[model samples]
Target: MKYVLFVYGDEKPWADAGAAEREAVYAQWGAYESLLTEHGARRGGNELAASATATTIRKQDGQVLITDGPFAETVEQISGYMVVEAADQAQAVEFAKAQPGEVFLRAVHDYGLDHLAPAEAPPGVRYTLLVYGPGGQETTPEQAAASAQEHYAYIELLLARGAFLDTVALQGLDTAALVRKPGVEVLITHGPFAETVEHLGGYYEIVAKDLDEAIELAKALPEPVVEVRPVVEYSG
Candidate 1:
């Protein structure tokens, strides 16, 4: 099976730390990655940028609205995440506890991303796989292309199997913000925080049989961390 480890922490320390101190902290993460590699449990992971530069977008009443900032404001911000292949929830929890901050572990559910489209989803709760990590801007163009190719192929396979619903690769923080009350003459702008760390770089909507099946799909992807959350069916 596979699991997504959402690593959260206060960004003040790292953001305020000296260059050397920050480097040391990064080194710690390197060590952790090495450990995962040694155990053959490291599927993928990443260190996101600060959350100061984010763009949020939304559409309503046939109009699209754009703004700046994350989807929510919180004290314990997401610092990073890791995608790991484990035996079960217990094993996944063990890996999370070893991380350097508070972590959240949620089982992936089997639901397709079709609900996001105009067509109705089949009779069942679907799942949305949120891919969080460093954006392509963090790397050289060549590297980003190569990494994207790997991910694209993985996605293609899922699509072929009728499991993929949608896939979107987002722009970097420089172009991030929030769009509130779209489709109106006037728009409100709530930009991203001044200090940005992590952004939702991309995402995938897929259908799986259950948590285990979802993990299997995640384990095959090349993303650093893939978050699987249940999509609630609204009757209203």
Candidate 2:
């Protein structure tokens, strides 16, 4: 089956890591990637920028409302993700747990959701994963940035798999676009989503063995912390 591995966790620590430390940490992932490739397990994936650079887009009343920061507020936001072709949810969870990083495992999921109106989800196959961090667990803010190095490989493994789907990443929250709307009174504000915990960092859409298999695959998803849900099919 295919699974969207929602990879969430602290970024600054890894991103801030020294050259040597960064290289070593990511190097550990090489073995995991090879394991997947050797077994023909991964599909595809991608690395995300910090939430700071992300632009949230919401379709409202025939209009695409673009906003700033993350889609919601949270501390452990999605940093990156991968797509894997696991035999079942168990395998998916295994793959997720194996994701390379330093933060104590945070969260994992299979990934899903019903597409918004006017936006028809692709037909072929795809998985959706929202990455987030565990509250009170992620280390200091600086360390969060340090761990971003593993993102490159985390994404590449899925690309290696055959079920790779669409991927979107954030690059650090942008405060300039903050705005509040009241009828015609749209007030722009400066801030980010949840400053504590529970925010999207990035996501992966993929095809898995089957829904049941997908659930197993999600069980193995990696962390900061996250949840998984199936895409609600709406054929209107």
Score each candidate by Cα lDDT: 0.57, 0.49
- Model 2, 1-236: lDDT tens digits are 56555455566786689999977876876777787898798765545556664444443465444445555555565565566677765565556556663111112232232221113333443445555544334467677555544544444555455445554443333311222333555343433334554445555565555544443333334444433334423355
Cα displacement (angstroms), candidate 1, residue 42, comes to 0.7
Shift in Å, residue 91, candidate 1: 0.7
Encode model 1's per-residue lDDT on 6-26: one tens digit a residue: 566677987789989977876
What is the clash count of model 1? 25
Model 1, residue 25: distance off in Å is: 1.2
Model 2: how far is 40 from its true place, Å?
Answer: 1.1
Please, what is the TM-score per model? 0.48, 0.45
Candidate 2, after superposition: displacement of residue 127 in Å?
16
Best by TM-score: 1
Give the Å shift of residue 100 in candidate 1: 1.5
